[model samples]
Target: MEWFILFIVGVVGGVIGSLMGLGGGVIVVPALLYLSAYGLIGDISPQLAVGTSLLAVIATGLSSTLAYYKKGNVDIKSGLLFFIGSGPGGVFGSWLNGFLDAETFTLYFGIFIILVSLLLFLQNRLTPVDLPKDNRVMMTYVDAKGIEHQYGYHLPIAVIISFVVGCTSGLFGIGGGALMVPAMLLLFRFPPHIAVATSMFMILLSSTTSSLTHLYLGNIEWILALLLVPGAWFGAKMGAAINTRLKPVTVVLLLRIFLLIFGLRLIIDGLL
Candidate 1:
């Protein structure tokens, strides 16, 4: 029964995470924690849940990234830059995780999730100002459907944001797509598809690094992770297919609602 539940959670997480570029940690971590709290999983701590979720993120993110890549949505150069900035940040975050106790980690994780939810909600309301032509780096890319998009971004800002996202990923076992996708849209001016694809690529890097660190720390629950992987892999492919059909606004709205519900639940659980 527990294995079935974990598989279901993995499917849901993989679908949503792939669609949103979140790598599924947003779903997996909370679900694991809840299962542990309910005594369905014996002696699983928040730290272990987080670490295990990151391992799942690696599989899910890679699966989604490949799907996105075949569609020509991934910006490899941009992803590489973000990866460089995020790698060390992931290490730092994982190291920090060791210092936090279960209760404090739960509280912090809940707060972070709420903050991410608020950011997603507010993103649509904020208007973007055009940058000077000289200050921006131009991008031209073709999508899965052979449609081309042209845009520009501020590279330094993107690197900085990616670094922060990396830290969060390492700390909480999230893919950082909740933060990175929005930042790419608002600050870097990436198209929705590009943002999702590129974020997944970054997640692939960040989650790998964090998972390795967690493995060394003996934090990951391998049995649980193995059960989750197959579902996550299949769901990622489904999500990548769905991404091509959905409007960007609809995606954001759905993600906002999902984040809000999960964020509030985490907060309530922490309080209890």
Candidate 2:
């Protein structure tokens, strides 16, 4: 029964993760924790939950990547550059996780989620439909379709950001796409759809390393992760299909609402 519920959770998480390029942690972590506390997820340790979530992200990333690939939205050149740094960063973050307690991880995760949500909200509110140039950390490349895309931040800066994002993902059992997508769009100047695709591709690298490290350390719960993957794959496809149609401002607003709700939940949980 517990297994069945976890599987259902995975499906729902996967669908959301794929659609939003959030990498599933935003949904999976809180849901798992809440369910576990209620004894709805069976006998699962908090560390196990974290580990399982990381492993599940690997599947989510792959599913999202494949979905984005089908849409021709992924930017391989930039994604390769970002992946180089993030791949190892995942291992480093996972190693660091060994040093922290479950509460510490949860608290930090909650805070980070809240912060991202706020950033998304601000970006939506401040940036007009036809926003001007923002050269904070830009990069540029030509896509397969002959579109010469310009992004913020050079390759080196993106690598540096990837390292930090990877560490957070490893430490907190997240996919880090939530951070990566925004960074790509707002900081790197990639379009939102392109950013989502690229972020998914990069997450494949980080999540793979993180999952492997966790699995080797006996952190992952295979049964749960497996259950989550199928649903996530379908969700990713759905998300990719909708990416172009959805307005960036609307997406940000919705994502912000999700973040606010999740953030408040975490804060309340931490306080209680």
Candidate 3:
């Protein structure tokens, strides 16, 4: 029954997360919390919940990255550059998690969630012309459809942000896609679809590194993570298919709503 519950959560989380470029931790964490409270997973703690969620994010990232890559949305150069910093930061964050309390972790997560929410809201309101693109570091890619796109400038910023987000993911068991997608869109001026696809590529590397580190630190639940992967895989493929048919505004609004709900749920969980 517990595994069944996890499978369902994983599918739903993956679908929503793939659509919005999230790590699915927002959904996974809550599911873990409920199951643990009911003794569904014996003696499971919040830390385990976070760690397991991170591990699941690793799977989701791998699946989504492959799908996006097939569709020609990944920016390999930029993704590799960001991973250089994020990979190490993830290890560091996992190490630090061993010393932190649940309240401390929750507080940090709450603050980040709120900040991400606000940033997305504000960005949506801004006109494209009002948002200036940084052209410092550039990368080019050809999509599956044979469309060529170039992204230039803000390479340094992308690296810096990826490191920060990776650290958080390592610590909190998230994929940091919330921040990554926005960074790609707002900082690098990527189209929403491209931003999401690229974010998946970046998160795959970052989350895998972090998950492996966390697993070594005794934070991962392999059984649970394995159970979730199948559902996540199915959902990701479905979501990727949907991405091609949806309007940008519609996708953004849907993502915003999901984030808001997740943020609110987390906030309530923290307060209680």
The number of the candidate with the highest TM-score is 1
Task: Put the candidates in TM-score order, highest first.
Answer: 1, 3, 2
TM-score, candidate 3, is 0.86
Cα lDDT tens digits for candidate 1, 1-272 = 99999998888889888988988888898889888888987778877987899988888899999999998789888888888778887888888888887777877888888898898788777765566677767889776567787777677776788888888888998889988988788766788889999999999998898888888999999899998888888888888889887755776687678778877777776777
Candidate 1 residue spans exceeding 4 A from truth:
132-136, 143-148, 248-255
Against the true structure, candidate 2 has what lDDT? 0.73
In model 3, the clashing pairs are 135-153, 136-153, 137-153
Candidate 3 C-alpha lDDT tens digits along 1-272 = 88888898888777766777877776787677667767987766656877888867766777777888787776777778888778887888878778766656555666666776676778777654323454577667666577777666466666788888888778777688877777777567776777887777777888888888877878877788888888887777767677767755675676567667766766777677
> What TM-score does each of the candidates earn?
0.93, 0.86, 0.86
What is each predicted model's overall lDDT from 0 to 1? Answer: 0.85, 0.73, 0.74
Winning candidate number (lDDT) = 1
Q: By the lDDT metric, which is better: model 2 or model 3?
A: 3
Among all windows of 10 consecutive residues in model 3, the one with the lowest summed lDDT is: 126-135
For residue 247, what is the lDDT in candidate 1? 59
